[model samples]
Target: MPHRPNTPCRHPGCANLVPYGQQYCETHKLLHPEALRSAGSRGYGSRWQRESKAYLRAHPLCAECARQGKYTKATVVDHIKPHRGDPALFWDRANWQPLCKPCHDKKTWNEDKNPVYSY
Candidate 1:
């Protein structure tokens, strides 16, 4: 088998090489930190949800819950901090997490007590 040359990332000004057909290098492939805040308002609602579902399906263990050995199926992408007051963090993948239904419900209930809106 012959080795193939890596292609440069397609994202503008990105110098890193990536596999063919990929628009960004590994680091830039995900949404930018600040971009997440307005990503929902920028018309990424259902599309983002689909993406989140796919991500969870591919990695079924809830990031946090799994750390604690909780093996429940992850069904929600939760913001580490409420996106309402900090809209800029909305689209940030680092700010998002895969959570099981029970964990999500608990988080929601906790949020309800604080009452912050992201939408």
Candidate 2:
């Protein structure tokens, strides 16, 4: 049997060669098991992914950045109001807004830490 051509592991700083079909090497994959989870298991499904893509396509700019007069591109579709696991609000288009990853993460972190926090 002949050795297959080696491809670099996708993880940054990793030098390990992975089989063609795999993304991350075994070490990284084991360290980040969530990467192996399905989209639905990660709080998103095909429907949400589709909706998010459409919203981003239409919006293009991050809402928060726009509010500050900056025009950064949005990469996340955020819920204006937390759905709190409610299917109705969770799927509500009116509650959705496109946000850059940084803005979204900061907003989400603040909201998670305090419901009525400011500044």
Candidate 3:
């Protein structure tokens, strides 16, 4: 069997190569601590499941889709502002919003790709 080729580290401007299927080289991997945490560790445990489900029940329509004049069913309860492991933000009902999977995915993608730096 042939060995897989190493791939470049995902961190910007990093020249180190890492094993296939690995996202970043050793030096850069530690920079993304969130990637090491499981969904439960990130606060999406049973309690979150229960609360998010109830939130979806109360807000069935996707907020984004509603804005666009569509009636999409919401499958996700997203944080209007990312919780980032902050318990206060995580449990805040006022910061929550209903979003369909597509809208949720798009929003998450954009947020991750272009993070807002708070100085």
Q: Judged by TM-score, which candidate is best?
A: 3
Tens digits of per-residue lDDT, candidate 1, 17-119, equal 9776555677865633333346666545897778787777777777768788767778888887766544478667778888887888898778744543233
- Of candidates 3 and 1, the better by TM-score: 3
In terms of lDDT, the poorest run of 10 residues in model 2 is: 110-119
- Model 1 segments more than 4 A misplaced: 1-44, 85-87, 116-119
How are the candidates ranked when ordered by lDDT, highest leading? 3, 2, 1
| lDDT tens readout by residue for model 2, 10-72 | 666789998876767988786544458775875688888888899899999999999999999
TM-score of each: 0.52, 0.62, 0.86
Query: Each candidate: what lDDT?
Result: 0.70, 0.82, 0.91
Per candidate, the number of residue pairs that clash is 3, 0, 0
- In model 2, the Cα lDDT at residue 79 comes to 94
Global local distance difference test of model 2: 0.82
Per-residue lDDT value at 12 in model 1: 55
Write candidate 3's Cα lDDT for 1-119 as tens digits: 99999999877678899999888788977776677788999999999999999999999999999999999999999999998779999999999999999999999998877755454
What C-alpha lDDT, on a 0 to 100 scale, does residue 74 get in candidate 2? 98
Off by over 4 Å in 2: 1-43, 115-119
